[model samples]
Target: MTDHRYVCSSCGKTHEGLPTDWGFKLPDEVFDLSYLDKYRRTRSNTDLCSLDESRFFIRGLLSIPFTHREGEFAWGVWAEVSKATHDFYLENYSNEMAQGTKASGVLANTIPGFPEITGQALDIAFQNSKSRPFFSFPRSAEHELAADQRDGIGHNRHHQFLELCGHFDESEA
Candidate 1:
């Protein structure tokens, strides 16, 4: 098995290590008892484990919605970023907000010579509407075209998540 490490550049905090697994959680405001129970039951060692207050970094991102056949109505987004790079973004995020600068995902494509990291979304969101709405990952022209054409509320959307994560692996990281 391969070991994957995700670090936060801003706070110098390390998230998961080796054999990396990714997951997302609902914001505190949207919490529900039923979902919390499910989350508690399904939680495992492979889930995203963190030691610091930092939540996430930036590498690439993708969102997919489950189809009617797969589930009623649910969606997921995944982000992959190395520690240093993510730290930079987190700083930028704070600066941008504090200075009233416009928020943009352009950095997702501008990092040069950094290994591309990808994430697998194995968890379901409690409130899909509250999930991250945009992805900040660099994408190939082909992917952009396919994503635009696909209706984003079914199995097709889920496949796009897999496609984005499939672009690279631990060796690239």
Candidate 2:
């Protein structure tokens, strides 16, 4: 299998590598709890692995993609950023994010090429939400138009995360 790597443009830090084909093209949303749990554990310690202020930022980074927007807030893209990028965003945007300032400001500030990066993620997320990955919509019609766009954003997020880790896997999305 080929190896994959994801680099953080902000700090130029590289995250863990993975088998290029390990998860890509497998299947999205397999709900691999064991894998997630293991990753969670590994990720928790990452904060301490970098800048002192970055610990909480790492957790927040992970939260970006894992958590879905409930009402007016959702940022599940951070989990995928290179550790350095993760820390950068947290360090810069923690205050804004906490205060609920320009929503994507944190990302725009921390992640390099964040404008396009976020836009890409937006496409996949819109598609995923329309598919109702975790929950079913009350009506198909209500979510009909935004389905592909939403999921498309989610797809981009997955791809970006994989890219950050230097891994190119998409099956787990």
Candidate 3:
């Protein structure tokens, strides 16, 4: 069996186990077959996978896939939210979409139902530009404001994005 160990921060306790009851819904013929074949060989033995492969999986989410650049290139904004928030957003997303109106300027931060999705923005990324995309390590980095991250109205859209997601506090973003 795999020998990976995890420690809980709350109880200061350690435990050994594999992630259980995990399910991901993805499209058929999505993943790279070669990568899947290699992973299958070690599936029962370990949790190890190449970072480049992991980045490949993440970049697949991009609307426009450009392979001209090397390394990980994340495009667009994203946030990690709680399961409750995710479900709520999914259920009411259509309503929000229907209610959403076009902003006066190019990039408007406010969307009718975006806050519901972002309310529990446990982490966020400020990848507002195709160039200079944010590369998140194991966890989210500090909320340092960047040019593309800032909207036209003096508010950081990334910060606004966090607020819409539901964190009313400025520091939270």
Candidate 4:
């Protein structure tokens, strides 16, 4: 991969590499709670979270291809799943045989520039134990993100995402 460098617009510090991946630290629902309520109602690790003994969430990659690049960019986002689905994932998390397991979920993070996607239906596909699950919009969905996933995005859009994530200033481009 090519290493790109920039001064962060948000932090004003030099950062190396073109950031190809961005992630949400927590699901929006859990994050919106008051400090005490958040601690009392949510249990979370880096990969999984449960809120109020009911809502279950899993972190996964929502990948978007680069129209002219060799690989893809990804957002490490969260998805809300049914208790049964979350339990199944926990059960098979360490098993390679769980590859190809599928479940349905709702997007739990509001993606930058795609705020409408937060509650959209998603199709989650489990890969091998070495990888996080992959989240995708339904093929028939009309959201712009679905279209981006299907058609890929150009460099301009990719740069826009970087700016949106506070990685760099567009004026510096």
Among all candidates shown, the one with the greatest TM-score: 4
Between 2 and 4, whose lDDT is larger?
A: 4
lDDT per residue as tens, model 3, 1-173? 43644443335676653211111122112223466664553221111112222211111111211232322212233232334433333344345342322111011111223323211212222232232122222223122222222212222443343344343342224
* lDDT string, candidate 2, 27-127, tens digits: 11212236754355333332222222322222222122222322211222222334554444445533432332112111211232233332122111111
TM-scores of the candidates in the order shown: 0.26, 0.22, 0.22, 0.88
lDDT of 1 by residue, 1-173 (tens): 55545553335676553212223342221223366654653322221211233333332223433344543222222233344434444455434333322222222121112223223221111112222324422333234322432434544444344344442343365
Query: Candidate 3: what lDDT?
Result: 0.27
lDDT of 4 by residue, 110-142 (tens): 988888888999999998878999999999899
What do the candidate models score in CA lDDT, each in turn?
A: 0.32, 0.29, 0.27, 0.88
Candidate with top lDDT is: 4
Q: State in Å the error of residue 55, model 4.
A: 0.7
Over 4 Å off in model 4, which ranges?
A: 1-3, 6-16, 169-173
Q: Which ten-residue region of model 3 has the weakest summed lDDT?
A: 101-110
Worst 10 residues of 1 by lDDT: 121-130
- Residue 48 displacement in candidate 1 (angstroms): 10
Residue 49, candidate 3: C-alpha displacement in angstroms: 19
Task: Give the higher-TM-score candidate: 2 or 4.
Answer: 4
Model 2 regions more than 4 Å off: 1-41, 45-79, 97-120, 123-173
Q: Which stretches of model 1 miss by more than 4 angstroms? A: 1-23, 26-76, 97-133, 136-173
